[model samples]
Target: MLQVEHLHKSFADFKAVAGADLTVRQGDLVAVIGPNGAGKTTLFNLITGHLTPDRGRILFKDVDVTGLPAHEICRKGIARSFQIANIFPRLSVFRNVQVSVLSQKKLSHTLFRPAQTLVVEETNRILDSVGLSDKKLDIAGSLSHGDKRVLEIAIALGNEPELLILDEPTAGMSPDETTTTMDLVKRLATEQGLTILFCEHDMDVVFNVATSIMVMQHGQTIIQGRPQEVRQNVTVQEAYLGGA
Candidate 1:
């Protein structure tokens, strides 16, 4: 569904991504893992157009999308959630997602029609899928950190993405919250058939849920394979897993 080839990005003398490569197929749940400064997020930025690549090609569904603006890529069926929860803090959970749904449909909530009546079913369905139906009326800022992250994901779903990119989806959460979030991710891929690519620091989370794993080091992908292969590989163990 997505291909990144020999991607490179730099800031001054520091190469954030150097000749990196990644491939994500439809219905596949792929995880990108690396230590700090490994360039996972930079690679994501380049693909999503937050940062254009200094060099390389990005293709989605056989079309060259390199350097496309973020919104254009999003409209092309890519959606993402950030490392930090990005949501409307002051809006109710329902309105938070409603705004996204409205934006996706290119409509604005004018005084003539409150957004409340528009896309009601679609908004509720997204909230329900993310397990936030009960909290729909609650203030977004008042929710727990985990719920806030989930809300961000629900908002991403508003874009009706074919591929979902989650950066550190469970960066800060309780064990239960992590499990809940990962379960949702798995369901999104297996049940809903959404292609997923995520970068996660939690090894257990990556290994447990990912259909494939890509290990990066020094700004390039050193290994991309199944979970078992990554777990046993001596280089991966030494470089990132702390295996002797």
Candidate 2:
């Protein structure tokens, strides 16, 4: 559960997030949608501690977390994947996930015992959930773009997140790959009871997977509602959704 109240952030006269507020309840698969320069990513940065808000508050589970460091927020059960695939290029898929698992446990790999061996089963389970089990031994950099994205998600799941923030999860992918990724995300929300908040440009993905949608424009959240409501709203249509 997360609550953002009157959040604002700016960079030298350009307001990236202007008085935005929203609440994400447990088990929500919420989508944040908007056009370019809409401040979607900036809002995520504020919540995740990449950028401290200039004003307002970000609360998770009744505790105020505004201005907490990114690592601290992550340890508090928030995890994210970036717009670009953030993977360890040289690490094997299994090892990449093992790093996250070990990081979550506050242990670093040393020559004495490889972290991968210690968390092999759990790491493999994450890989399997993301449908990358077969690529476990493959180098992360060598995988296709879609697979790389999946790997990044596997790493996020390693943190055992209560809320997963995915920035452009399907930014570049074939339709099939996109569908696979959406299905995997939906399954995680359903089976694992994970809460999700994602910023996405793909309307199809947004409409299909999101239980609720928030439309942002000019650095502010202008509309927040269910999929059908967002689709038919005249203001949202003109502002962002491009409805007919």
Candidate 3:
């Protein structure tokens, strides 16, 4: 569903992503695992159109989207969630999701009737999918950290993306919360048939949830294969496992 060929991005004097190539098939759950400065996020930025690649092409479905704007890329059915909780502090959970639904319809005008009334059914369905239906009326800022993470996912789901890019979905959660988040992500991929590409630090989470894994080191792909294949790779062991 997504193809990135010979991608490269540099910042002034440093190369963040160098000659990276990857392909994510429909309904596949792929994990991009690497240490700090491994350029995982940089690759995501380029794919999502937050950063334009200096070289190579980004093809979504079959069309080139290398230089497209972020919103344009999103409209093409790719949605991303940040490593941090990117939620509105003052808005209610319902309102936050309603905004995403409205944006998808190009209804940015706040005065375009009441957004809640306009997209209430659709917003509730999205929130329900992410397991946040009960918290819809709660103030977003008042939710616990774990709940906030779920809310972030809910907001991303509001776009009804074909390919979901989650940046550290389980980043700061407790053990239980991390497990819950992983389960939700798995369901999204397997049941909802959404293709998932995520950058994660937790080895257990990556191995457990990823259908395939790509290991990056020094801004380059070191290994790409199934979990068992990657786990036994000599270079992966030396670079990531041993370091872990």
> Per-residue CA lDDT of candidate 2, range 24-116, in tens?
999999999989988999999999999999999999999999999999999999999999889999999999998899889877666355555
Model 1 regions lying over 4 Å from their true place:
110-118
**Candidate 3 residue 227 C-alpha distance from true site, Å:** 1.1
> How many pairs of residues in model 3 come into backbone collision?
0
Candidate 3 runs further than 4 Å off = 108-118
**After superposing candidate 2, which stretches have Cα over 4 Å from the reference?**
110-118
Model 2, C-alpha of 222: deviation from truth (Å)? 0.5
Alpha-carbon RMSD of each model: 1.7, 1.7, 1.9
All candidates: TM-score: 0.96, 0.96, 0.95
Please provide the root mean square deviation of candidate 1 (C-alpha atoms, Å).
1.7
TM-score winner, 2 or 3? 2
lDDT string, candidate 1, 13-129, tens digits: 999999898999999999999998899989888888888999999999999999999999999999999988899999999999988998888886663455546588899999989
Q: Tens digit of lDDT per residue, candidate 3, span 111-216?
A: 5557546688889888888888898999999999998988998888888899999999999899999999999999999889999999999999999999989888
* Winner by lDDT between candidate 3 and candidate 2: 2
